[model samples]
Target: MHESLSFLAATYVGQPIWLWLAFLAFIGLLLWIDLGVVNNKDGVVSAKKSAGMWASFSAIAVAFGAYVYFVYEPDPLYYMSPDNLNQQAVLQYFTGYLLETALAFDNIFVIGMIFTFFAVPREYQHRVLFWGIMGAIVFRAIFISLGAAIVNEFTWVLFIFAAFLIYTGWKMIFGGDHEMDLNKNPVLKFLRKRMNITDTIENHNFFVKKPDPKGSGRLVLFATPLFLALVMVEVVDVIFAVDSVPAIFAVTKDPFIVYTSNIFAILGLRSMYFMLAEAVARFKYLKYGLSMVLVLIGVKIIWNFGLYKGWKDMTGEALVPYLEPQWSLIATLGLIGGSMAYSWIKTRGEQNPA
Candidate 1:
């Protein structure tokens, strides 16, 4: 018993193992409540319900940040400490959460496209999204772990991530929105070729046993269009992670911080999708705003990379030092907010054009 307690007390990725365990347990409970109680029936999720879910997840995220600030360590009292680093952690959490949520807003449009391409029914979409999020959770963990390992071992690699973010952000800002041709997606084509896929969704079931078309009267499990949509959604998340995981690392490299903020942001976005699915086109200019957010984070990373390497030692107390987390949070909020407001107004103008 003592050994078990001690083991829980052990630290991993800058946090106690027990903290990680508690978080996973909390997330599990939330998923149960979501799928078992809130959405027990597989009907169309209303925008009002989506808003409520988003609010619940956002509130949970805020509560977790408070927990981090006040109770995670619980040794010297984080906020009152001389250095006040605990407060910094809370800001980083919110910053990372906001950044991730904004970056992933584009996903709603993509998801809508995926569902349309597959002709998935509204009743079945929830199940696909639930399983898709499950896949995302697993894949994001792997990516974060690998990224954490690579960055911790070789600090220079962070700069490469920074460069990648800059280039991607530039593309996002300048590159006009292009329609994705799911028909040409090689992943979809490959899955269709390799898997025993059904022509249509099979009553919300990912896999259904159907009679083998061969003369044998045996039942064979076949993948449904629902499953294909789920896989495509999962694949889209992995692609988004390539951009977001690095961006969050810049916010704060604490894997726990990065992972929790990321998953919660994703959860929030999943719910928000239902709210915005039909109206995603109204906020079209948000693409630039999100892209600029990435660029800003990249610049922050580059500055820190240079500052810590040799500039800090040379400048000593004279330099501005690392980019402050609070300012990053503020800048992120301002950029996103401004973009949202502008997009809404422009969209309204176009719709009401006299």
Candidate 2:
């Protein structure tokens, strides 16, 4: 037992194992307080209540950033200088958090659609989202670990990520049809064929025992619409992560920064969805902002690579200087903020012309 505990305390990936354990404990506590304490009785979440929860979660995330700023010690080899490491780590965390949160707005829209297609009740929606977020946490951790390993081993993989981001962004900007039909979803189709699924929800239960339809006396476990909705939600996140994980990596390669920022953004997703579901349509221009963000980050990645390689033989000395994290953070915030501002103003003007 002593040796096992000692091994668990040892450092991995630049931070002590205890730090990772602490983070996991913190997340587990938040989940408990959310599902078991504050929302012990499941019901419809009012927008007002959701707004308050969103603010509280955002505050916690910001406070966590402060903790990282003050407590984290960046390795001297990876950082530019020890004097600025704390500030840089904090900035990267917030930047990544903001980017992931902004990108997740799209997820909210998709989730809302999924629930609508399934005719999921407002009261039951939160339960699905709660479990969906739990699945997302696990999926994102896997993706982040795999991505970090790939980037660390083959620096050229960053270029591929950059290219993919650019391609996805360009499609978002130019693509006209984003509508999805849940009935046509491959996962749903496959599950329907393989499993005993019921057309109606059975309270909030995902699975329930029911009489088999084939004239058999034995009861069979059947999946409810709620379960299918949960599965769809999980699959939707996986699709979004392909774009978002790369975008965060473009900000910083540190696993701690990457993982914490992604989790923090996702932790508040349920509240965010409740707060914005009805009004998300007003932010029509936000997609343009998101697309631009991806394009800019893609460009930044390529530019950073060029700086290291002397700009493809254009000069003996390196050209296209590498962008500092501070500048990247500023750029990211400006683009997202400006886009949102434009969206709000445009929508408001249309709603009430002066």
Candidate 3:
């Protein structure tokens, strides 16, 4: 099955450092221009503006998608048959993008809650989300690298990932603890034990350094709650990554497509958070839909494993073969889009009362 899928794992993992650096710089430039130039407005980012930004980024992705399509298909680079060009590449990009975006929807929901928890002003929310997404990019890069390494070395790691997805799905569907207990976090505890934390948040600043006792120095430190919130966000990101990264692997093993799409999806997340924050609460059923997707994908992964191991009889296999990587990608994207659309329509109907 792996051979048949035309896995481009080596091509992606061996992506040049220069290429990676250039990609990072481009994304960073866009982010700076977005926050500094286009969205210099003082008030909340309105729906119209947010929608426009979403469209712009999506258009960029599609243009890149066309380049990828033309480069690989018909034109043919390193492959023999034009059809030999892996469909997994395109599907993987789309699947990884969809999974990352859906996972980010949960992140946005939590960010909204966090903003409410702190009573942060609307104008500052974008700044916070910007920093949060920046942190997420770093953390997720670390996560995807570690995860890809493990999954590459030990195929059984997929089983562990599948189990994790099932457990996470169960929790999401059952509505697990949504409480944000700062005290329970180890980083917060350590900070409380070692340092003095101000009772009030001062102008939403996360860090404040004191003058050094030795005369010519400074001691830098984060505000206690800021540290706590940062820790909380990191924890949430790790949880989401565990489910999302594996979900994409079920689509394709092409790390370039997976990682690139993941980056693009996350790069847009701060803007998405601003746009979705208020409306998220109304889409109560969306979590259930995502949970179901997680469960279904997890089951698919397990079933594929069984098929690979030849656990099923020939007749059983003949009846229903394992899901293909391309089909899996398409299905995952379709499910997420359909679920969001359904939730939006339902929410709209409720608002209209007709």
Span of ten consecutive residues with least summed lDDT in model 2: 74-83
Q: lDDT per residue, candidate 2, 96-146, as tens digits?
A: 999999998889889999999999999999899989999999999899989
lDDT of each: 0.83, 0.87, 0.67
Candidate 1 residue-wise lDDT, 202-305, digit = tens: 78788999899775899988999888898899889988898999999877777888899998988887798888887788888887888888888888887766
What C-alpha lDDT, on a 0 to 100 scale, does residue 35 get in candidate 2?
91
How displaced is residue 188 in candidate 1, in Å? Answer: 1.6
**Considering every candidate listed, which one attains the maximal TM-score?**
2
Report the error of model 1 at residue 214, Å: 2.0
Order of candidates by TM-score, top first?
2, 1, 3
Which of candidates 2 and 3 is the stronger one according to lDDT? Answer: 2
Determine which window of 10 residues in candidate 3 has minimal summed lDDT: 72-81
Off by over 4 Å in 3: 1-12, 40-43, 72-83, 175-177, 209-231, 308-322, 349-354
